[model samples]
Target: MRGFRPGLVPTLVVAVLVPLMVCLGFWQLSRGEYKRVLMQQYAERRVAPPMDSTELAQTTDPAFRVVELQGHFDVEHSILLDNRQHDGQVGVELLQPFLDRATGAWLLVNRGWLPWPDRRTPPVFSTPEQPVSVQAWVYVAPGATFQLHADPVAAPWPRLVTAIEPDKLWAELGRSGFSYELRQQGGPGAYRTDWPVVSMGPEKHLGYAVQWFAMAAALFGLFLYLGWHNAGRPHGKHHESNQHV
Candidate 1:
């Protein structure tokens, strides 16, 4: 027992704890990095080469980003999705069908924002009956379902739709040829173009990661303290326990 020191316990615990904490920290960093890469991909896709919406329009996967759409607007089928906010303002997006006379294809154009007021219905839009050409980035709306039921059915046109999938929409309306689907182009010309670009929420995710790591570190510390060092115990519990054994 001569020259035995009491510091060894804390040192050993910290050695194990630090490595675990370090791994957790690195894991969160990696997640942040992955998010950054994805964001970069999104940005690059936006600026890469513009595509023809009618030609690229397919019944398969919903194409996302950088599509060129040119055709006449089918004003009759225009729909407004509720609850969209941009830059501290609330608004509704204008969605209309573009028909390519040559290919017989259709593209859904999300024209820009129209300021919305509190009302039972979306603001009415006067649409052009003649042929119109439109270009926009593409995106797919997420599918949403409740417990054992689909969400509510959408209103008939010039009506508001909630969580409508483009493909399902095309089928329901008997849509045909057109290229690219553009989202967030909500503004004038055809619709309001005032909506902000889509944010993948990298900052929010990184913040969440930090919170998780913090909780892990805190819980580890609390467990170590309670099980080994607290509860009216003396300062030399490790030494006493080790020596007594």
Candidate 2:
């Protein structure tokens, strides 16, 4: 009929959409579990042998993990990531390249943390020259961002670096070693490596999951009511010609 009841079509549409929404919500629930498991494995596998960075593919498994490379710290090339702040204090972490005297393999070490006075104020440093061992985890460099002075083409130290280019560093050293950046584990340095607290913004996945589930529930209830309304109407008077499409 050209003239329809106020809530008839919406009720029918809602009935179907409810189930569709529930299915989607449960799918996300499953996905969350998957991420949790992978994270747990990553934590557990930290003690296992470190993978050769060049051989590792992009993976969520924890098998490829932290490493211990013994060599002297090349502090001359050592630099700090700019504008890194932690606990409301402005500071930078020390990143030094550790060259293995035996195998010649090297690791770019984020040795530790430091405090700075102002954004304009460059941090002070006093890294020792004696051979030092570095323990770190392999981390792929993130994408380019504005505001941070991450330059890859320039010289290693005192030159602001915005991104981690293993290829460029390897070239700077005259030989390629690994593909990932070394996240320094605490050793014999006063530099800070405390993980930064990321602000949980509105764009996070968990918030979206809740919204989707609410919509699904509303749809399911509407559909159930419609099904009953049509079924319980006086037999034949239920209007056979008015069947929902």
- What are the C-alpha RMSDs, in order, of all predicted structures? 6.8, 7.6
lDDT per residue for candidate 2 within 1-245, as digits (tens), equals 22323256776677577767777777666656555554555566566776544333444532327765667877778777666667787777677777766567766667666887766766778776777666677654223346444465665465555455666777877865666566766776646765521222223445556778998876666566666665555556456656753
CA-RMSD of model 1: 6.8
lDDT for each residue of candidate 1 in 4-95, tens digit (9 for 90 to 100): 23256665766677667667766667766776665566678777776654446443644445655445777777878666777767777777
In the predicted model 2, the residue pairs found to clash are 15-223, 112-191, 112-192, 113-191, 113-192, 150-161, 150-162, 151-161, 151-162
Where model 2 places Cα greater than 4 Å from the true spot, the runs are 1-35, 48-64, 140-152, 196-204, 212-245
Return the lDDT, model 2, position 162: 49
Q: How does residue 156 of candidate 1 score in lDDT?
A: 69
Taking all chains together, each candidate's TM-score versus the true structure is 0.68, 0.61
- What value does the lDDT take at residue 83 in candidate 2? 68
Highest-scoring model, lDDT = 2
Top TM-score model: 1
Candidate 2 matches the true fold with a TM-score of 0.61
- lDDT value for candidate 1? 0.61
